[model samples]
Target: MLIDIFHDTVCPWCRIGKKHLFDALAKWQEQEVHIRWHPFLLDDTVPAEGYEFRNFMQNRKGIKAEELQHLFDYTQREGEAAGVKLDFEKIRLAVNTKLAHQLIALAPTNIKNDVVEAIYRAYFEEGLNIGDINVIVAIGTAYQMNATELKLQLNDRDVVDAVVAESAFARLNGINSVPFFIMNNQVKVNGSHSVEVFLEALNSTALLDIPAKI
Candidate 1:
């Protein structure tokens, strides 16, 4: 079965959701699973250089410093429960994910999933600016991808267009959230759902035998 996952690299929730879904899959030994990761930009308007993290979050969420801390604390605790680490303080900027998405889109099939996971870690854990070409090239290099080639491809107008277009298509289809999942192109699951929810979806007949019409 094919599991289409729409996500953004900077989204900590997507990391948690991925962990939970994979945990569920570990327990489910029934069918072969193929995961296809797609891009969903959290804020495409973020400039190429990006914004200061704290200030941007404060303005974006309309909260004061203490309130921002509260939000971060809550998210951190949730991440802990899901076995994912979120180092918000280490993040200096809230960057546009366009360049990162391009890298993922052009990655070799065998290493594409790994590239996505590493990009998430780079942003949420290491707090690197994924929007920067140098940062992306470093990550790609770890996966044995040719750095010079990867850099060129990431800047390729065609590749950038495809990556951004995928995000646009998701919005047009009414999917405005990240970490959204489509099981066998039949069952649609949204948000950072629980392992149980994922398991149930995996077992459902709609995804197994009777696929619902798209």
Candidate 2:
């Protein structure tokens, strides 16, 4: 089974939703699944330096800081229930995700998930400025990639265009939210779903067989 996940790193729901999906995968360890991480930038118009989370949410959602914080707190609780550690207070940056998406595109198919998780943790948990070249370079280095070469590739016009094109395609397909999961090229599941939902989907596709674990 192939699962194409369209998500943004800084998106709280995306982060939480991914954990749920992973938990489902882990629960069904006998299943052989190939997961692909795709680009889906929530704030594609935001500058490279990004914006402060509080300010961006207030302006975009027309809500106050308290309300946003409450939402974050609720999300954090859900993440924790799924054994995901969400560092809400640590996540301070919200930059343009064009470059991050491009990097994901350039990565080898085998290591794409590793690279995606690293970027997500860096921005949401470690509070790193993921839009900065230096930070991206370090992230690439941590993944044993050629940082200098990646820095050079970051300027490629094709890379930027590809990310934008993917986002537009997703929108055209009725994807108005992040963490959208497309399974087996036919199942279009939007938003973050629970582990049970994913497991049921897997079973329906005959991609998973559940047996007693003792």
Candidate 3:
């Protein structure tokens, strides 16, 4: 089955969704799955470099006083339950996710998934500034990607244009949020969901009857 996922690197909820989906994938090793990560910027209007995530959340979500405490508490507990370590305090910013998304788009097929997971871990768990070029290069280097070449490609006009086009396509397709999963090009599963939901989708007639290995 093919799963087209639209998500942003800085989205905590997206991380939760990925954790749940991965859990389901691990359980269904016999089932062949092809995953594609698509670009979806939460704040594309932001500058090339992003803004501080804490302030962005505070202003955007308007969580103050007791509400803020409750929100964090709930998120932390939920993250723990999902097996994702979310270090919100260490998170400094939520810069433009376009660059990160672009990386995912251009990554070679063999390592694209690993690259996506690495960036997610860097932002959500390690609390690193994912907006910076150096940080991105560091992550890419771990996968033996050419950091110098990546720096050049990061701002390549063609790459930027392609990413922008993808973003516009996503918007036109009615994607209003991150972590949106379009299963088998038919069912749209929005937001984070339990492993059961993924399992059910995979077991449906749409995805069943995998061709036997030769």
Candidate 4:
């Protein structure tokens, strides 16, 4: 089975949703599964330097700072339940994620998911500016990717266009949200679903291939 995940690095729910999907995979050991990550830029117009995280959320949601805290509190609890940490208070910027997505695209298949998680951890947990080229270069190098070559590729015009185009392709396909999943190119699930929902999708697809599993 193949799972294509459309997500932006800065989305807190996307991180939680990723954990849920992996949790389901842990139980569904009946078939080999491959995952492909795709970019879904939440706000593509964000400047390269990024926007102030608190103000951006407040304006985008039309909610007061305290009200936003309430929402974040709920999300934090949900993230904890999902075994993922989401420190909203620590975040300072809503970064332009095109470069981050490019790094994920450049990563080898085996280490791609790890690279994705590292980006999430850096932005959400450590409050690092992932939009910065130096930060991304460091991340790539930490994973044993060639630092100088990775830096060059990250700055290449073609790579930027490729990541941007991939994001556009998602919007063209009517996928305007993060954490969207397509299982076996048949099951379409949106939002941050529970582990059971993911398992249901996995089992349904697995049954099609191995009918006698029950």
Scored by TM-score, the top model is: 4
RMSD of 4: 3.0
Query: Which 10 residues in a row give candidate 2 its minimum summed lDDT?
Result: 205-214
Ranking by TM-score: 4, 1, 2, 3
lDDT of 2 by residue, 60-170 (tens): 889998998898889888877877677878867678888777788888878888888888788777888888878877877787889878988888898889889988888
Best by lDDT: 4
Higher-scoring candidate on TM-score, 3 or 4? 4
Candidate 4 Cα deviation (angstroms), residue 156: 0.8
Number of clashing residue pairs in every model? 0, 1, 2, 0
lDDT per residue as tens, model 3, 47-155 = 7566866667778888775676678778878889989887877777778777787678768889998999899899877888777778888888788888889989987
lDDT of 4 at 109: 93
Error of 1 at 74 (Å): 0.8
Whole-model lDDT values for every prediction = 0.88, 0.79, 0.80, 0.90
Residue 149 lDDT (model 3): 92
Write one digit per residue (lDDT tens) for candidate 1, span 1-214. Answer: 7889999988888998998898889999677777888899889899999999999999998999999999999988888998888988889999999999888887888999899889989998999999899999999999998988887888789998898899999999989888899988878889888899989999983346854333
Question: Which runs in model 3 stand beyond 4 Å of their true positions?
Answer: 205-214
Instruction: Give me the overall lDDT of model 1.
Output: 0.88
Residue pairs clashing in model 2 are: 50-95
| Models sorted by lDDT, best on top | 4, 1, 3, 2
Predicted structure 4, TM vs. truth: 0.96
